[model samples]
Target: MADSLNCSSGNCSSAQEAFGLSEGHFALVKAAVLGCIFLLASFSNLFLLHALWKRRNRRTRTQLFLLHLCLADLVVAFFQVLPQFSIEITHRFKGSDLVCRAVKYLQVVGMFASTYMIVAMTIDRYHAVCKPMVSFFRGSFRRYVAISAAWLISLAFSAPQMFIFSLQEVEKKVFDCWATFIEPWGGRIYITWITLSVFVLPALILMYCQIKICAGIY
Candidate 1:
């Protein structure tokens, strides 16, 4: 019985060591992946933006949306992915409270902008296909309005992130950028709201528009 207990303890210690090692490896992999994503997104978006600019005179409404989408994606690549990559490499956020809050705010801004831009583009397509006459008459005005609304909404919605996140001491002196919520309920409600806004609502809108588009096509 004593021998068996000793063997079990030894095995547990070994398993813990293995787990720690694997976690370190995972962190490196995550950093590498994020770096690749940032690079690819930046390069591709910039190239596309330049191409679009060259054809500015002949661009369509869809192309305009795409141009803004690329801008939003570049924001994600710079503010979101690049910061995350740096955090992964450093193993923690290395910034002041204001910097942390700004990063968090811009991160969500990019997400919101990207999501709503897609929604706007899809709705534009829906209008073009299903309500061609209406689209033709009001397309220019509505296109500008949709793009502006998407950006304004993104900025407004992301404001909370700036207030919620700040640099805090996680250890004796080691600080990290963390979000402070009002215990359990705050976290849950905030997450639910984010999910609904960023994923669920947009998904539903996209789905509805796509269905209508298909029906119109048929």
Candidate 2:
């Protein structure tokens, strides 16, 4: 029985070691793959931005909104993508607490901005169809306003992430960076609100507009 126990212990130890090795290997692979993807995406967005800028005088409202969205995505990809890639490559948390907070902020802001842009686009489409007499749709100012509002709303929503995220050093002395609101119950409430505000509300709005548009056409 003692011999059998010794054999089981050895096997468990070996398994753990293998798991750790696999984790490290996976992390490295993730870093490489994500790095390439982000690099390409960032450059592509930059080129698009440049092209749009060169033709700014001739830009339409829809085009302007799209350019803003592309710009936001590019910034997020440029700033946060490399950091995430580094985290995956090292697999050993060496980043500072400040950077961890920044990462969380970037992630949230990116998402908020992107979603807002989509919402703005939906609203723009609704306006174009529902209020065909509105000459503003043909003008570029409406798009500029939408782009500005999208950024403002994104910043407001992302403000919470800056306060929520933190860095903790575990028993193994490795730093784990994560975002968690300090308030337990409030955090849940906040998440619920965010879900409704960012997702459910927008989805309902889009659906309503789409249905109305379709019915109008019919």
Candidate 3:
């Protein structure tokens, strides 16, 4: 029995060591991948923006949407990917309460803007293909309205992040930005709302628009 216990303990220690090593390797790989993404997204989007600016006078509705989409993607790269890369390297958020709140707010705003902007563009395409006369009559007005609504909704929806996240002391002196929620139900409710608004609803809208566009074409 003594020998068996010793053997089990040794196996457990080895397993833990292997797990720790693998986790470290994963972190390194993740940081590298995020760094590459940040660089590529920033450079490509900036170049595209410059190209668009040079042709701004002759921009079409679709081109305008693409420009806004590129801007949203840049926000994601800076606010979401860059911050995550920093966290992976440092293993903690390094900032004051205001900075933490601002970062969290902008992160969700980027996600919301990127998603809803794509949805808006898809809906615009749907209108052009499926309802040509209406699209032609009010195209510019509707385009501006849709784009403005997407941005406004993004900003409003992300407001909760500002209140939910703050800098807090995790240990005696070690601080980190963390979210606080009421016990038991708060987190579940918040996550559910986000999933529905950000993913499920947008996905459904896109799928419906795509089907209508295809039917109109065929």
Candidate 4:
């Protein structure tokens, strides 16, 4: 009788696992956290975007590059929030495979574009301070060229995601979202390079430019 009871309990546990996030309470909590993050990011980015957008006619080379950066950030925030919103309502992932891929792509593209644009902005500031008389720095056309280069470079950087992403099922047979090939070691390498190129290098360059500009002003 005990063997039969154990087998019956196992069946009951399996059935419970199969249901996957079928209840609303836990989903609501997740949704609340996700929504707060999205709203905060989106609202902050929207203000930046608005400032850039409102000054459309004052399109200096620097302003134009900033505008694109703001736009890219806005797009990312908008797309990033959708899945969170949907999951809140359904309490389970109801998206198609294509939707998942598209969301991932948007997230990657947004992050890539933002990183590269910040880099471009640093280089622009560098040129403005260090080579003020150069024709390339003087013209608005160069701003467009810089923005284009940022976009292209960002796309190249994120190209690996296309091959690396895959949908997987958890032990409970629930679908889980992840990038399959991006292990911790790979992430460390990527982060190291990204930190050096995007944050540290650009920040140093920007600081140099700011100091030069301030010196010149004084």
Which has the greatest TM-score? 1
Residue-wise lDDT of candidate 4 within 131-161, one digit each (tens)? 7777364545566677898888777766665
**Could you report the Cα RMSD, in angstroms, for every candidate shown?**
8.0, 8.3, 7.9, 9.4
Estimate, for each residue in 129-205, the C-alpha lDDT of model 2 and write its tens digit.
77776735463566668778989988888787667666765437656665454455666676787788789987898
Checking candidate 1 for backbone clashes, the offending pairs are none
TM-score of each: 0.88, 0.78, 0.88, 0.67
Q: How good is model 1 by TM-score?
A: 0.88
TM-score leaderboard ranking: 1, 3, 2, 4
Query: Residue 216, candidate 4: how far off, in angstroms?
Result: 5.8
Q: Whose lDDT is higher: candidate 2's or candidate 4's?
A: 2
Lowest lDDT 10-mer window, candidate 1?
A: 1-10
lDDT score at residue 199, model 2, on the 0-100 scale = 93
TM-score for predicted model 4 compared with the true structure: 0.67
Model 3: per-residue Cα lDDT over 121-187, one tens digit each: 9999999999999999999999999999999999999999998788877668977777777565667
**Alpha-carbon local distance difference test for all models:** 0.85, 0.70, 0.85, 0.63
Predicted candidate 1 versus true structure: per-residue lDDT over 59-178, tens digit per residue: 999799999999999999999999988877787888888898999899999999999999999999999999999999999999999999999999998898987787877668878777
Which stretches of model 1 miss by more than 4 angstroms? 1-21
Worst 10 residues of 3 by lDDT: 1-10
- Give every collision pair in model 2: none
